[model samples]
Target: MAMIDLTRGLRSHPVRPPASGIARRRSFWERIHLDPWLLGMLLLLMLAGLVVLYSASGQHLQVPIAQGVRFGVALTVMLVLAQFTPATFQRWAFPAYLAGVLMLVAVELIGDMGMGAQRWLVIPGVIRFQPSELMKLAMPMMVASYLCRRELPPRVRDLAVCGLLIGLPVVLIAKQPDLGTSLLVATAGVFVVLLAGLTWRFIAILALLATAALPLLWMNLHNYQRQRVLTFLDPNSDPLGSGWNIIQSTTAIGSGGLLGKGWLQGTQSQLEFLPERHTDFIVAVLGEEFGLVGMLAFLMLYLVIVMRGIVMAGGAQNTFGRLLAGSIILTFFIYVFVNVGMVSGILPVVGVPLPLVSFGGTSSVTLMAGFGILMAIHTHRRLLPR
Candidate 1:
């Protein structure tokens, strides 16, 4: 035979198309791991947020610009995270969770103080970040990874171990006096547990125990934390102090009837009646400027995104992926629910931002990164078999 059979050789060793041709076929954005539906939702939310922020900031040109910059940075993080495969996330899951705990410990040792809470760690001349935010993402991953390794309908021991894993970070965060984040972090882990097939009997027992311990828990709360609970009961109790924000926010929202007073015409925001109009209470501005119509539209968009996220979770290739994606979606809805409920005078103000609509770079980035993990679960090739 000849050294090579031309047709057989060519058939056995196929050549890839030219690099230039391949490059021309797909742009960087096209190659990135992102769901177009989710991306569209995010972009629309940002646009709505910026429009509201502009009016909320009294039409200050720079405010929206700054928010836009934060969005761009967060978007970059999401896209980069998307490039990672689910296997990579799985491999890194425990390590990331451990690192988050170590960071929480570091925060306890040398965290910075701001707004009367030790929630952030800021170097004298370097970066500042919140360990709790890291926990928000890490908690679910750790729980999912551990649970997936065990049998379905985990035994008591598995549940105990899961509780320990969750409680450790919660205690650390609560010690930081950030009740909001501690609660959220715990919920994130718990969501994974429930979705992992934890029995309902245990859930009900826990609920009963929690109810029985409410008085004790109340006593354990810090003065301000206790005040927030009481304030939720009666805003008029401290209207000039803790309650002023809630009172003002409700007024702003209620005043935005049918079609609102027209854009940039909200007396509550423009006249400076609502506090934190650009951040936690931005939804109040939306309610004031766009009226009921605007609020409903925004809610619809948020619901769709939440549903899509849940759908992705159910579609995950493996158990870990399912638990993680589902928890993230549940936690996201919790964020939105808590913020809106607080502003609407039903829930206590927990210092939660309105998810993607709030003017918080840290929260925004953390959320987008979580979505990255979600996209990774959905887009990555089948890793572990079902």
Candidate 2:
């Protein structure tokens, strides 16, 4: 039903006179101040996430309430970011990107280490920052700013410059041993470049090159990374080792069958077999407890958000807005996909988290920030000439 409404909204002719009149007539809460449809969808998903997180996190009451507070904070950030114009974003794109790169450097030089990775930097009494998360937002903005400067469908020279912009941060993040972030950062930049009209032939060539480089990439992967791929291929071979996560997560999902084991009744999570049940593997918890029906309903909500994003991208008034919005939205979908795929044993596990649903402070805030930019693009469409 959400998809159907979005489809109809897309099909309707967008005349500015009525749109502006409607905007003027809207209540303070009804304006693009917050996209009504998107906000409604987010509220539903976040509420559901809270419920799932409660169960996933050992059914603790404080867990969902604390996440609700984080959701409130993240929502406030989104609202503040939404107030900015696309022009403001475009104006600041390069600086934001540059700052991200510099911070990633800082993280490398003096970042705190945790869980065997140098991905965080705590400022004594201040925030514990993750620059890679910032790159997830900045990379697309950088590529959009770069491509928006040139003609539609960039030249080879243009592509090379964009490649440098993308590769630098990706390499930096990967050096921090964060393959998940590196992949997402690269994906965000590449999507901007692709949407900005890099030709299909060039994309195909890049794909071929990447495929050819697979063996080299595999050779360069960390020992655990290679073990993950091997475990993906044959999880049973090392049931007590690297494959434990995949085997357990898949069991939770598969056993849920259709309707699920019922909320809070999941043996895998309640009994403590699933790792990261509140973060990357939360979907398995959802699958195990709520079953297929619940999962599909949640997915429908997710697709609604994606659809609205695509619509916003299509409606953007400028090249930069379009490219940035589209890249952010697609990158969001990919993030969710990577998380789910890894947990379900279809892909090698990386550090990716399920977007809004995953229990992580950094990723949840970053994703909401991107959506804030999306709202800015959609709502700030110039009033049609009277």
**Cα lDDT tens digits for candidate 2, 1-386:** 33334444554554333446555655454354568788788888898898899999998898888888888888988999999899999888899999999999998999999999999989889889798999999899988998998987998898899989999999999999999899999999999988977667888999999999999998889999899889989999999988899999999998898999998999999999999999999999999998889889888888888998898789998899999999999998998789888988889899798877878788888989998999888888764432
Name the best candidate (by TM-score).
2
Tell how far residue 292 is off in model 1, in angstroms: 1.0
Backbone clashes in model 1, listed as residue pairs? none
RMSD vs true structure, all candidates: 5.4, 5.6
Residue 325 in model 2: shift from native, Å? 0.4
Q: In candidate 1, residue 80 scores what lDDT?
A: 91
Instruction: Indicate the worst ten consecutive residues by lDDT in candidate 1.
Output: 1-10
